[model samples]
Target: MEMRAKKSSRSSTSNTSGSTTTTAVERKEIERRRRQQMKSLCAKLASLIPKEHYSSKDAMTQLGSLDEAATYIKRLKERVEELRHKSASARLLAAGSGTRRGGGGGGASTSSAATTTASGGAGSSEEAGRREDDMPPAVVEVRQHNDGSSLDVVLISSAARPFKLHEVVTVLEEEGAETVNANLSVAGTKIFYTIHCKVRTYVR
Candidate 1:
């Protein structure tokens, strides 16, 4: 009986030792896997950062620590935001400049057209009388289709109190032209009118 009891105790001790060894091995494996995952994540982060942010020596050495990498990433984000703001501001300035240039050109063209119309056939005296009467002359351009069935008209004039659009419509109706589409815009004191019409031709 004593011998049997001793044998049983020895077996129990052996089992306990084996369990301890297995646990130790498991812990070591877990630690190794954790280290491998950390290295992989660091490599991915380093790839995202631009080379210019780091010194030439540091680029070759790679980022020394996680803290340094994080700081560099923060700086890169700030720089990108600054560049985006500058780009947006540049676009807005360009758009404003274009608008001003277009407005100036429109004013210049209106002045030139008025001068030409006044000097062309009215003579200096009649032009002076028209100016004295404060009657702003209208500029009209007409284009007819080859079939004489359609016309496109553009009218540019000053915005008088009564507005001459009604008279223009009435005249078009009397000339056997039916208005199809019209677009009107006012820039400063000048009014731009575009009209499309269909006209009937009477065959004699």
Candidate 2:
């Protein structure tokens, strides 16, 4: 009976030792897999960041890559806000134009009556002046993209002006702006142009 008990105790000790060894091996494997997953995730994150934001030597550490990604996200958020503000301003401008048209008819009629009463001999000059007043002035606005790789231009020009699309394109090309998209809309004798460009060089 004593020998049997000793054998049973020894067997149990060996079993416990074996189980501990197996558990240790399992833990090591789990840790290795976790590290591999983390490495893969870091690589994917680095891929999404722009190359320009990377290190000058191109040897980006994991922490450096993550930092660049954070900065890029910040810039994107700011760009979104800027675009929203521009959209709001455009809406307000449209509303104001509508209001002005509604209220300006009476004032314009009164002015015409006064002008006629003041002079009959200057009818041709008055008509010329009126035509000029009816036409909107030429407006050009150029904005750089947040990435510094592109430009957006909004141009409002009078239809009466001797403007040519090809000439404008040629000028932009000369200034190192490659036009990617060009849109034209006409409203009440005013020509609106929206041009999107990829810039190869700095344009003044």
| Best model per TM-score | 2
Please provide, for model 1 over 144-203, each residue's C-alpha lDDT reduced to its tens digit, 9 standing for 90 to 100.
Answer: 676656777677665542234555666666556688988899987777888788875568
CA-lDDT, candidates in order: 0.64, 0.69
lDDT of 2 by residue, 1-204 (tens): 999999999999999999999999999999999988887887899888878766555437666777777888888877874664355335434433443344336546656666677466367656856885776756666787778677786777666642356556666675667889999999887778888888775459
Instruction: Give the C-alpha miss distance for residue 67 in model 1, angstroms.
Output: 2.7
Error of 1 at 128 (Å): 22
Q: For candidate 2, which ten residues in a row score worst on lDDT?
A: 95-104
lDDT of 2: 0.69
Q: After TM-score superposition, what is the CA distance of residue 48 in candidate 1 from its true location, in Å?
A: 5.1
Q: After superposition, how far is residue 115 of candidate 2 from its true place, in Å?
A: 15
User: What TM-score would each prediction reach against the true structure?
Assistant: 0.44, 0.49
